[model samples]
Target: MSATAAISVRGLEKSYKGSRQARSPVLKGVDFEVARGSIFALLGSNGAGKTTAVRILSTLLKPDAGTALVEGASVVEEAQRVREAISLTGQFAAVDEILTGRENLVLVAKLRHLPSPGDIADGLLERFDLVEAGGRKVATYSGGMRRRLDIAMSLIGSPSVIFLDEPTTGLDPEARLEVWKVVKELTEQGTTVLLTTQYLEEAEQLADRIAILHGGTIIANGTLAELKALLPPAKVEYVEKQPSLEEIFLSLTGSTKQGDHS
Candidate 1:
């Protein structure tokens, strides 16, 4: 593992017992490294073992074979230490519907045994741009706001690494963009993020490095430009440009819809 890598996996493997006498392999010798204070995206389709890998790295599941280290601590041997260093926000929002945004954060802080939970919750509310909505019940919050509060709860422990499993799933375009901004700010402030996303554009927009997983293994790993370079060169041709429907509509209406108009 690289000394500077915040999260490191080597020869990782996992298998689950099936109905028959055979076992189904989920992660087959998966390997990757995430640098400190940078975004690393695991790009794959459903059943590509993206979530399984996240579960292992976050100490929710044990790998049948291989080693994973978070901030130089072994996930298997130092599970508690690893837990202390990481937070995970799953595909769905985990906020309490009956609790206000501020209350939810404070509750997490209290669970983590942090001092000054109220102050911590207040700071997170402002950090996630939910100050005005902090006092409102989570049930009344928008999808974007709920997602923001969910992430805010994860930060209550001051984790060094965060696992975002398909973080933008089920979010509107505007809401997805909002979450993207929050992720960008986290890396800027020296927090390492490991994101699993099926959205190629999301990886292109956010990942400092990307690993494409297939059949439980990393088939390709590199920056966006590097990955593009691996593909055969495209043929160049000159043709008359045509305006897209979005451009045509914008030109006609002079404005765009606020959310998913489709």
Candidate 2:
């Protein structure tokens, strides 16, 4: 593991066992390194093994082979240590439904055994713009509000690394931007983040570097410009109109949308 690498994985492999002719791999000889205090994005389609890799790094699941190091500590040998140093926010909001926004934050703080749970909760609430909704039950909050609270709870422990698994999946355009702003704040504060998203725009907007997984392996890995350079420059079509085609289609067909507009 490099001294500056927050995470280092070499020859990582995982497989599920079932009846007959087993040894089907989810990750095949995976190798990568994430620099300290950087935002790294992992991109892949569904069942591409991105989530499995995150689970291993977060110490929720163990790899069948190879080694993983988080902050230079062996993930397999020091699984507990890795868990202590990292936090994960998955596809859905992880906030407690019954608890108020403030209570949820405080609960996480207490779980992490922070020195000052109340202060941490208050600070996070204010930082995330949840103070106005602090007293409201999470179940009653808007989608965006609940998502904000979930992210706020994730930060209460002050873990050096965070894994966000499609944090903006169900958010509206404005809500997605709000989540992006929070992610930017985390990086600015020198926190290392590993984010997994299927959204290409999200990776382009936020990742310092990106790794694209296809068929359970890293098919491509580099910065946004570098990745784009690998492919022909796209020809963007710009149209000036009061209402866009997508908007018209959605209005006409009533299709739901995801992600930011700009």
Candidate 3:
């Protein structure tokens, strides 16, 4: 692990077993570093080992080959300490369906040994705008609401590093934007966040640096600007000599997407 990085991986590898057949390797000697307090996006197609990498970093799974470190602690040798520094929200919201929103938050806070579970639970509920529905069971919550609660629960211990694996997967456009705002706020507060997503736009919206993974390896890793520079600067064409469809799209969408060619 580098002194400056919040999370680091070097030659990491993971494989799954199946009978006596050769184990299928998911991550093949991957290497990357997430700078402290930055949103680093891990972009990949489905089954490209994005979740596997996240699992290793979050200490939910160990790498079969090489090393992974979180906040300068070895994930294999110092897993407990590494786990102390990180929180993870996986593909599914981990909230209990039987528990009310407030109950779920309080449960997590209590599990974290927070001194004031009530205060912490209330604070997160309000911050996530779940105050009105706080008393409702998670089963009654919408997908977006459940996702918010899941993320809110992860913050109970205020872990310095957060690993989000496709955090906004099932969210609608508006809900996705709301989640993006929350992720941005996390980075602004000096929380290091490593996000894994298949959506290029999501990475462009939240990531300070993007790593594009393919076939179990990172094919490209750089800032949006740096990666954009590697390609030809775009040219525009208007329909009525006024503005083209791309122009209208750009006007509404913003220049960020042009750089999101990941």
What are the lDDT figures for the candidates, one per model? 0.87, 0.82, 0.84
TM-score of 1: 0.90
- Angstrom error of the Cα, residue 238, model 3: value is 6.2
Model 2 residue runs over 4 Å out of place are 19-21, 233-262
Candidate 2 lDDT by residue in tens digits, 36-126: 8899998776677888999999988989999999988888899889888988999899878898988888887887777888899889889
Candidate achieving higher TM-score, 1 or 2 = 1
Residue-level lDDT tens digits of model 3 in 1-262: 6799998889999999868887988889999999999999988767778989988887888789999889889998999999899899988899899989999999988887879999999999999999999999899988888888898999888899999999988788987887898899888989999999878688877889988776788767888776665554565555323332223223333343433321
Candidate 2: give the clashing pairs.
none
Query: How large is the C-alpha RMSD of every model relative to the true structure?
Result: 7.6, 6.6, 5.8
The best candidate by lDDT is 1
Full-model lDDT, candidate 2: 0.82
- Model 1 has an lDDT value of 0.87
Q: Taking the tens digit of each residue's C-alpha lDDT, what string does model 1 give over 1-262? A: 8999999999999999999959999999999999999999997766778999999999999999999999999999999999989999999999999999999999998888889999999999999999999999999998888999999999887899999999989999999999999999999999999999877678888999988877788877887666765544545568534433223223333345312211
Rank candidates by lDDT, best first. 1, 3, 2
Model 3's lDDT to the true fold? 0.84
